[model samples]
Target: MPPAEKTAWDLARAATHANLPLLGTPMSQVVDRLLSARIRQNAFKVRPATRAGVMVSGGGYQGKTETVCEIAAVFEDSWRELHGSHPETVPGSRDLWAPVAYVQTPVTAKPKSTCKAILDFYGAPTKGMDLPELIRQVAASLNDHGTKVLVLDDITRLRMHRADDQDTLDLIRAFMSMHVTLVLVGVDIPGSGLLREGRGRGGKSVNGWEPTQTERRFDLVELDRFRYDTDEQITAWTTHLAGIENALRLLDARPGMLTEGRMPEYLFARTNGVVGLLERLIEDGSTEAIVTGTERLTEPLLDSLPLTLADSVGRDVAAGEVPALPAASRQPGTRPGRRRNTSFDDRGSAASTA
Candidate 1:
């Protein structure tokens, strides 16, 4: 191919792989159904009462944030469609009419900073405001914007030992009373001190706060990595891979490039069933395939790529646990060659290897 044509083709392939759609898995489906129902119910309620929220907890790279955000975006789209024109702007004023507000909790979150994050989402000024004032403004903004769902990702960042974090947790609970369905996404929330009761002086509860309130107010759900032990799980995993394979745009790609033979098992071993890691591996492998003129995914090609930090840790944890691929599935003379370091090589040498 000509130089210009090759560059264009390479760019197009990169874009296609980068924007691959989120494949539906059993966990995402369940989260959608549950979160959708809760949001719908909260939106319809006219009476003043605390809305029950959902807490999506899981390990890193389990797609917790992506899944919840997709559901929230879908809800917002349908809501605007149902409300007809001028859905983004209020009828008589320039106020924003947002049905969903998504924000991330600050890494070193305190009660004041947490409230500031919410205010920042609405483009509201929080300067010179104290904690109480910040809280009042946040509530007002939620009402003014007509927000029905508020998503706070990375909720476990709040360390409950500090008084500020304790108050932040309380502030989050207070937001539930504002009639917005709260969707808290975090890693291992149950293990986080957010749910544990604080010990008070003389063994009494601090300020008579009820720790079970969190458990009762929010429906905690977990998103786990895909498992291969059961037949149903195997089907789900392979189906997911097939969806990805179908979306790929390589010139020489063949059907079952990811799902047939030992590829599925090999991929499972590499990613440990984490969707994010699997996508990374596929994307990097595909880019290498295009650069090297192979134009198709293969075991050796994927194996040549390096693992992310998360994947490396997961591999260490699952060492000797993942089942080994059968001997018959291995190709007789195929092995992954070492990736050549071309950063220090001249253009001619790099082109020669390519």
Candidate 2:
């Protein structure tokens, strides 16, 4: 092989060893847009009070975390390139300038704890401070360092009606009050009362009126699984397959035979168009081939991989389900395109055979 091909092959082999985030379209573009908007806002001499934040709500395994993390990585890289490798800090202050500050909401979702988490992210002292004091400290620190955006993940876990939930809401309000643009990412929490449409009729707030003031400040972005019933869905699947095929070629491995073949119909059907599930199927299938020294993907290999068919039975389905159609009753050796009545249940997986 040529030296370039040899290098590509080596990199591809290494890629298979790790489960890395795949750069897909809408996901990458949205992250870039959010970051760019934040950067543009940062350039403003006076921060706009009406600057809207973004809320990305999706079901689990939709790459919410991965997408946000990717944004964080990109921001850090861009910041490092603009500033030197060593970030310039505030005069006589220990705070390091950060382009982005990412924190996961605590399980309790208490305002104090969540505030403390923000302070902790900024390396600020969080001991023995009242809620108001802590909030002030955190907001001040973020402003001091000029952090572009604050990303909070798992916002769905905030329990409504609980004092902690109110606290979480307060913490968020404090961030907004400080002119910090928030990038909230979490499972979809519809009718959570904490949010209200800008033009909503009547007074509809999730839990109470406390969140009413902050409710209209969000730009909502909801992500759903891809579909196979339409041309658009097929294009998404095919485009993703092209990316995977390119990856396989880099490994000098045989291209994805399953993707190249009719198996994508089966794949789209099984995974229900969830990017995460598709990624898992590809990752597991690729890793298996590499382990077994196959160096190529096949239908049987792709089919044999135990995939996460559905969720863990909150809405309806069981955890162990393989999520595929019962074998077609068509005569053997007769290939017929089949679309079953089975729909993608966003609730959870069902216990069914592959």
Candidate 3:
């Protein structure tokens, strides 16, 4: 007899399997761009004019958080794999090499708290140091490590009032002036203010180089959920699902049992094209398959499971409807609290919510 068809339980077991690598989605392309730019920047450290940075912005669970880990791993792993020990020299210069430093910006991040996080990351002694002194110490410590890159994740958490945010920006500007390549990742970033045209708080009347300074240092990259109705988006979504199916085959007891077709479409409908939601839906569906002894993930099996969080929003977005803009614009002229923003936090790190 031909082999039995695989059950929902089988796929569920596979979904929960450990060490799953990232599926190659649009976000992967953004990750590549970030790494490539960093490599180029690090390779020509002598040319301060050529020094630059990048910002990765996207909706929540659109892979902003995961991208942080992946980018850090790429920088550190690539260097370590190439050379067995910590780099003794900077990429382009004959200076000591310190690797990339990744820090989660504290919630409502103030300048002092942000600096403290940076200092702690470097193990720099900050005892009794004033803000100015702390900046000097942090810079010196990073310099000693020969650190070439500074990645500030969860940047959305920074307070947006002029006084509060200006301080944080000052710290970041200090790092950029040192020619350190900075990578900022967040979901709340609006394409305005320093991100669009350089203007500080209060409006067009305000003139400052700080916003310009930020724009000059970093280029922008965006990542969001795939759209359900668009053919192009559907192709990408199917492509992602195909990868998962291929991976499942490795553990599949029966060959040709996990073929793809309608499943991905159902998944897109359920997840409304959000990658994170898609993953969660699959996991939940698989778990039920195990519990109920359903053998395979069919339309009925998935429909019986709880709906993904993005179900409604994803569908609307796929149909070309834009969600309400965040109120935290960070643009100089925008009204306070009118600036739309999204939540961001570093994985497994303490945040300064105060």
Candidate 4:
């Protein structure tokens, strides 16, 4: 492990690992949803599989949330690059309201959020303070920023009804009308995975949680874990797994860290190979270490895992029988989220919400 990662892990020992489904779960959905929306740009005029789309998957505790946050950092960096003329204190300072895309935080809307409040966060969404003049403001906002992108991260928590696809689609369109791209990240809708039934049907024809489609007018890009990821992505995952194994070895903690065959098998079984779940497993495994301080985790730790994580980690990500590989070094910014995010508690020990 790199000195930095080691340093992070050290800091994470006290009270770093936990499951904040409230926050992490929603955040995960948002990342995939927004990526799907971005992919839409690729399929303009009913184009092929060109609509922008990106997904991160793997078992518990592997770093999916970390990956998403890393992405946010990318947007933040891009925002900084475009406006070398912004404040030094602000993280991504171009008035914030004038963002290239709209990003919804995991804030609860019990109090209700307005279009005005939403636009304001973007810094300068062309529309300024006068939203009643929506058309005019939208036009100006688009002209100033080009197409906007929106991400309602884990939007399901807002007390909104899932039954109404039209309403959902319209609401999405209303936000999209701001000329920015829109991303609806939510928990991976299970079933078929991410299949699209057709237009108006919210693109949900089974096969998983499909984003709702409006008027058969838009595109689709749902993320899935079954697909192959880049070698770099794989490298990041193994590095995390290796770290967990190393941690277990160091502390000599319980049930026994995953053995050769069981490593990936457990990963697949536990987390469906979703990176978040992989991390979660590590987190739990580590916690067991912290608590018992002596017991070997082994397959016993596998028992406490959530279904999604279990299915993924146990079945998919576990590198059964074969020894896992060493991690390849990574460059800053070049590697997104899970790579740089020290977000997990035990050095961001877990992120199990696949």
The candidate scoring highest on TM-score is: 1
Candidates, ranked, lDDT: 1, 2, 3, 4
lDDT of 3 by residue, 1-354 (tens): 233445554544565543245776876686677666675457457765535777777765666667666766677766666667544444655434567788887766677788888889877777888888888877776767766677887675544455677677667766776657777877646532435332434222144334455666677777777765555765787778766655542322233222354455456555556666666666666566555756456667766666545443422232122333222112332222233233453467677899
lDDT of 1 by residue, 84-139 (tens): 74443555777888899999888778889999999999999999999889999999
Clashes of each: 0, 8, 14, 115
Error of 3 at 232 (Å): 3.0
For model 4, where is the 10-residue window of minimal lDDT?
A: 314-323
How far is 282's C-alpha from truth in model 4 (Å)? 1.7
Q: Where is model 2 more than 4 Å wrong at Cα? A: 1-21, 27-35, 42-50, 79-89, 196-211, 249-258, 308-354
**Greater-lDDT candidate between 1 and 4:** 1
Best prediction by lDDT? 1
TM-score of 2: 0.74
TM-score sort, best first: 1, 2, 3, 4
Residue 304 in candidate 3, Cα distance off native in Å: 3.4
| Tens digit per residue, CA lDDT, model 4, 218-287 | 4433333421146654444454455555544325543335534345444544554455545556676666
lDDT (tens digit, per residue) of candidate 2 on 72-96? 6776687677777344366776657
What is the RMSD of candidate 2? 9.4
Model 3 bad stretches (over 4 Å): 1-19, 47-50, 81-84, 87-98, 191-211, 249-261, 307-354
